[model samples]
Target: MHSLGFEPNEITYGSVLSACTAFQVPIFGKQVYSLAMKNGFFSNGYVRAGMIDLFSKNCSFEDALRVFHDVFCENVVCWNAIISGAVKNGENRVALDLFHEMCCGSFLPNSYTFSSILGACAALEELDVGKGVQGWVIKCGAGDVFVETAIVDLYAKCGLMGEAVEEFLQMPIRNVVSWTTVISGFVQTDDSTCALKFFKDMRELGVEINNYTVTSVVTACAKLAMIEEAIQVHSWILKAGFYSDAAVGAALINMYSKIGEFDLSMLVFKDVGSLKNPVVWVAMISASAQNQNPGEALEIFRKMLQESLRLDKFCISSLLSVIGCLNLGRQIHCYTLKTGLVSDVSVGSALLTTYSKSGSLEESHKVFEQILERDNVSWASMIAGFAEHGCADQAIKLFGEMLLEEIVPDQMTLTATLTACSALRSLQKGKEIHGYALRIGVGKDVVVGGALVTMYSKCGTLELAKSVFDMLPQKDQVARSSLISGYAQNGYIEKALMLFFDMLMADLAIDSFTVSSVLGAIALLNRSDIGTQMHALIAKMGLDSDISVGSSLVTMYSKCGSIEECRKAFDQIEKPDLIGWTAMIVSYAQHGKGTEALRLYDLMRKEGIKPDSVTFVGVLSACSHNGLVEEAYIHLNSMAKDHGIEPGYRHYACMIDLLGRSGRLKEAESFINDIPIKPDALVWGTLLAACKVHGDIELGKLAAKKVMELEPCDAGAYVSFSNICADVGQWEEVLKIRSLMKGTGVKKEPGWSFV
Candidate 1:
């Protein structure tokens, strides 16, 4: 047309500018703007509005504003164009400011103008300003479905769910977008029930629910973990012929995985016609990881690699998490490096955590250092890695550095730092972190609260733990169990029992950890009846086979003197982990079944269960009880050589008892001296008691002296030494010890025996 010598009018220029905006061709839009200026048609209102829209859509806010200010006669279209342009460019605050400026003009805002302004308010989550705009929209009769939906979105994003729902109900008409927006808002607010109800109502009203609406509904089902509702949504999706929709497919996979319906998740994954969709693949990988099928997740990852599918950071991160095999994790890391995603923050963080979980903190820290744009997750992963690896000081140091960098720690970061504090038992440092959490408004976050409770509990401050527990708005199972365990550990048996009952009455879901905690409390209370009842409850809940629950049941029954019940619980665990094996071993040792305990220990090793420090304690105790002196020494040496577990104080105490009970006083004394750690009171007490039993008069005096040095005037130490002297016919020595006790005001209480 240009070559034919037809002169372009304002309408042609406006049409070209609108086309440029639609195609997001800013350079061509500028060329059109130039042509309009050359023809003296630049100031045409329609052309000017088109230019502004074109520039804004291209994110040229400066150019858009220039056109807006240069418009010779600004109308609502020009103003709305600039306002909407500002919003499109993510200059929401600027958009709101422009609306204020527009309000000062002679031209009043039309529905389009109001809609743009409401959108600005919603983007900013400015509830007060949104309300004002909403009122203006109502007064001007501009509250159409579009504007009404924006209002609902604004309220929902601001956490005013009631106001959002009220506005949704008041809307005179609704479209597919409006319905989807409201449902998504409810889902965002974590009101899955409300979101589902709205979806149901929308379907009953014969409103067409599109793929976006189905996706949101599926998300709500996933959040609620309601398998039935998820299946229902899945059916609706199938009926709507949207089963192949990527978002709906991904959501269904996530929902089924979260509900523990692995078969259904696989079906959804298989139904996704485009396995090439990275998002759907990511959802499947994440689902496998969440469902504790790490090998399957790796298989999916391998399949993705085999098909040459591009893996996103999310997919890499999910696979990194569950690939606990160190070699596999390193292989993934190498692949990430090859893909040039090693520097990606999410992947870097996941790699750090994966290496840490694989017991390679050095590699974890290397990955942490390689991440340039470290976000909250990156910092959190490093801190948690150090904490989990028992590098408390390093974790705390990193946390402090993170703060100094002015990065706000999220809940996970705080939880990791609190865990470090718990490891160090630094009560003061823990208090400082608690203060920080309160300042940062994550004090009541479920995970953070649970960490605080555990930190305080482990620090021997049950009152503070309970106080933190009480302050939590929602008592998560971890928080409840931590407080209950604290109470039980501190001998507040009744308080622990009461809290457990309260948790049950509140209908909080009882997980394995909670069941174990309550059973331990019952054991401490010596309530055999309650223990029996708890056993029944465990069986009823189908938790009897859970390893931790079964182990706790064994300990509980053993402590309550029900060895048969303890054995029964032990026999119930088809494949006991180290804890279950250790529990049974300790139970047998306590019941004078040393041979059985040692046999179980040998079997545990044969089953490839590596014995930890606790298991070593049980084994050593068994040897000590049966007077297997040489066997005890051999086992103690094997603790470090075979298992890489060093002899702790408990192990040393057991060794001393083994030697002393077998009348080997000299060797017991030498073993105490050879202990790597500073021997505590238990060590000295064991030797002192052994001295009395074996009639070693001189060694008894030395052992008593060591005990007194450690315990500072222990009456039992004085009495034992005096008895040794009396047995040796050293009347003078006995009198001296008695006088020393009298002078020191260490009164010996009358001995009593339960049996």
Candidate 2:
């Protein structure tokens, strides 16, 4: 009106102030207020109330309060503006004080005043104050739908679900906001069941739900992890066109991800297409990480970065986890530094974990020390890092330091410390930690309990391990696997089999580790009946494609003397890794199929899978068994020259056995002398056996003497020397050998057959 040269009246100024408040343009509102003051229109009670509303909505509570006091109008509208603004600005206590002063003064509280005060009570979590406000609403007869909704939300926020429900039921009329408030309150309080029930009630009453109500219902289903209910909610979302909303889409993605439905999560994300925001991206990235697809997760992270999207702490932390690529982690660390997020404890903890899990222990320690202030998560990350890397002593030492600092260790910390104890087999320390856990009331934590079971089992106390397992409140997959592994590792094959069958009967989802543990027991027993049964189960469960399960299957079949089944298991792997390749090669070599073993080795190389130390050992053993001395020597030299795999004792032993069995005793002796490291007893034993085989008595005596000097208690060495002497009719030497054996107290092991 001023721009058009029309004299602006009080109504025009009031309308402009309200617009400024709604748009949160306080600077413009201030200028407009100045203009109104010059025009002598600012004294109007309506214009003053608009100014108070403007300042309050702009988070300028002091300004709003000044406007309220400067006008000195006994107007309730101005009072309501200042009160609601205080609550909006996070000054809940101040808002309550202002409301009290208003009530004690000439002004009577209105519906807006009651609504604002109730909100303040919710923010403060002052249930008693909120209840007083509820009584005030009742007495004032100002309980409109908005005020009543505020009352219900306050009760729910304070965890008084019964009161919240009573208030909701008493509402004379319900609107979308009122229904949404109750549902949101329940979801926030973790009462998803109640939240769903209320949502159903609201729907049956013909009340309409907006985007927020639908989102809350979806979140409730997510909390329940109820796939069927989630599907029904998803259908509602589609029919109601809620799927296009960013928050609802993100919620759907997260819900499906938690339910182990990755494909559905991706589908929801894809359906959002160009509408995807940071929330959707974070949900998808988190889904991939949780689903064990670290590679895919990283790819999505890269795409997000390429799009120039900003990353928050949650996004960075999620990416840091499950990031197998060290270079990428370093890049993310640099980004965090650039964004000044490294100072954030959560991001710092994630960085500490990433470096540790990536096998950079020194870097992990450096990150740990750089953190200015460490929380429990930071301390836990460092301790868990040390534990996972086999630095049990360091892990324990750091844990002690953490305790000395009075940092309360959570369940994760206790679990990590127990894992370290298990690795060190420090039963005494493990017991002390267990006592601490019980004292701290975390003894029943599923992860901590599982760790304790593993610790006891590894420390050679299987009975204690079983006791802990039995006492666990809930035996999750980890606990079951821990006990099963203990039994399998300690030669209790029958017990392991019994527990595995029991687990199956209970309808527990058998994971790769569980299957692997059971397969190990079957292998140790050499029972093809059980082994074949497991193999069939593996196929049925679609676990034949899993690398660990596949490898165990191969070994179990080979040990049971079913070479065909072993090959079949090997062939089932579409793209075998180094471990799978090595397992198959060893299976062939053990069965005396040296030719097939060599062929597999070549095929593995053709597939571009670099051979590790174990792979080389298998091929060398095959060549030695087939008496291919030249081939064995070529591969052994290539191991160090081409692959940079320095030949270890096993490789040298294989070479010695190869030449000695081929009657090349001199070459075997020369090879032993050429070994870079000191030859161990196994190396000398191979050479001595070859000496006896080739009838080189002098060389055989030298090798026998060296073996005795290396390991005097080696029964195989003494036996070989005795047999060589007897074959040569050296009676005096034979008597001397017998005397040596008797004096040394060395006894040969009693052999047993596996029928």
Candidate 3:
């Protein structure tokens, strides 16, 4: 019309500006504004309202406000436009202020004004303000379907589902938006049963369901893990031809995976027309990884790369979960850097976890530092990586830094930090974190509660640990097991046993750690009767084959002096790991079955199980017990050469005991002198015991002197020195030693036996 030389009027400008606003063409809207201004049509209310709508909808709220204030007169249309725009731009409080200002002025709020204000209320979760808005809606009689639906949404989003449902039932007329709002609300609140029920009611009423409704229903099914309801929803989706929608297909895939039907998820993936939708691809990848099909997940990602589909943050994060090696993880990390997706918090967090799990904590920390904006997940991932890699101090330091930056810790962050505190045995830091959890109102969350229990138990604060356990709303296996393990570790064997029996009485599922802890308590008690009953229970529960359980059984039987039962438990293990083999060898050594222990050590080496420092301790002890001098010498030499294990104090003590037992006192004394590290009192004390056996008076005096110098308060050294003197018929030396003990104020402790 302008090209035809027809002069544009206020109506003409207003219609064009409205079109621009509807299409979100801000540049064109600006050109129209200039044209309207030049034509002197700015004074017209129609053109003025159109310009405000155009600027506000396009998120130029300042320009919209300038246009509204420039006009001498304002209407409800301008007020509604600016308020709705503020809410859309996430300036919820500003929107509320604008609404109050408009209400104080001459303009009466229409249904559009009330709808926008209710939206601001929902965004802010301002239930009280929303109730006031509902009252205004009734007073003005402006409760149209749009306003009523907004009211429903306000109550729903605020988690007042009862009010939401009541409002919905009172609405004389309802649209698809109202039904979808209530269904999606229930799903968001974790009331999946109510969500599904609402969907069924909507279907029975013959309301046309949209893609959003179907997606919500599928999400509800996934949460409930109800495969039958999910299948029915899938059929309905197919009949409605909504299967072609990407979001619905993704939801169905996740639902099937949650129900443990990965094959059905695969079938749905093949049927989905959303091959180009990154959402569907991400869901399939996550489902495959979650269902233990990482290989398949990786293959699907390869196909996605082949298809040249754009990868979003969810796609990158899901792919990261399936990565099993550092090389593959680095490849993905390089890709993310090139695509500028590394700046995304989710992708950065995923990379951190992948590197951490693949034993590349350095790379994980580097990734964490490169994150442009660190969220709670990024901080938590780095902290957990430090804890997992045994950098407890670094983990604790990073947690403190996160707190200094005012990053509110989530459940995962608190739990990971607590784990680091436990590893460091920093009881003070653990208590501070517990206080933080309580302040944040997540103290009763089961995951955080269990972590608190573990942290306290590890720090040897059993009273605090039990308090946290008792405060937990639900006693999960982790909390119960941690408390039992703490009791056993602190010598409260009867308490541990009682808790184990209570767990059995309650029929709560017990994992291997719990059983192992109970076995440790039984071992401390030296009660073969209880151990036998535990063995029978283990067989019934099919936990006998578990390596940890088997190892604990071996140790328990050995402590009870039942070597045969220990061997039987060891034999039951199909493939013993390092801990299992070490347990059996140590048990045999303790029982004086040194020949059998040596045979098992040989068999373990042939089976390619490497011996650690502790393993050598057991091997050396067996040799000492059997008086195998030549074998002990060979094993001691091989410890550094073949296994790269520097012999510790225990290994040296075993050597001293062996040589002294064979009457080779000179060799034993020379060996102690030749130790690379300064020997502890235990090493010299071992030599003194040997001297008493061989009647080597002068060497016994030298060993006892070294022992006393190293440990001045050790009564055992004095007693051993006196015993050695008495054995050699040195009555004068014995009397002198007794007089010296009295002068030093040292008294011998009374000995007791476990039996």
Which one is best on lDDT? 3
Candidate 3, residue 180: CA error in Å? 4.8
Better of 1 and 2 by TM-score: 1
- How high is each candidate's TM-score? 0.76, 0.70, 0.73
Q: Model 1 segments beyond 4 Å from truth? A: 1-147, 150-173, 182-211, 214-275, 290-292, 440-453, 462-480, 501-515, 533-546, 572-575, 666-681, 709-711, 743-745, 752-755
Candidate 2 residue spans exceeding 4 A from truth: 1-246, 252-277, 281-309, 504-509, 540-542, 573-575, 608-610, 630-634, 637-645, 750-755
Model 1: weakest 10-residue lDDT segment is 223-232
lDDT of 1: 0.87
lDDT (C-alpha) at residue 45 in model 3: 80
lDDT of each: 0.87, 0.87, 0.90
Which RMSD does model 1 reach against the true structure?
6.5
Q: What is the C-alpha RMSD of each candidate to the true structure, in Å?
A: 6.5, 9.7, 6.8
Q: Sort the predicted structures by TM-score, highest score first.
A: 1, 3, 2
| Per-residue alpha-carbon lDDT of candidate 3 for residues 1-755, written as tens digits (9 for 90 to 100) | 99999999888998999899899898998898888888887777888888887887775777887887886657676777778878887778889998898888898999998999999999999999999999999998999999999999999999999999999999999999999999989988989999999998998999988888888899999843587888888998889898889998999999999888999999999988345898898889889878877778777777787888889777888778766757768878988999999977889999999999987999899999999878888999999999988898999999999989988999999999999999999999999999999999999999999999999999899999999999999999999999999999889999999999999999999999999999999999989999999999999999998999999999999999999999999999878999999999999899898898999999999999999999988999999899999999999999999989899999999999889888899998889889999999999999999998888889989999998899888898899999989987898999999898888888999999858
What TM-score does candidate 3 get on C-alpha atoms? 0.73
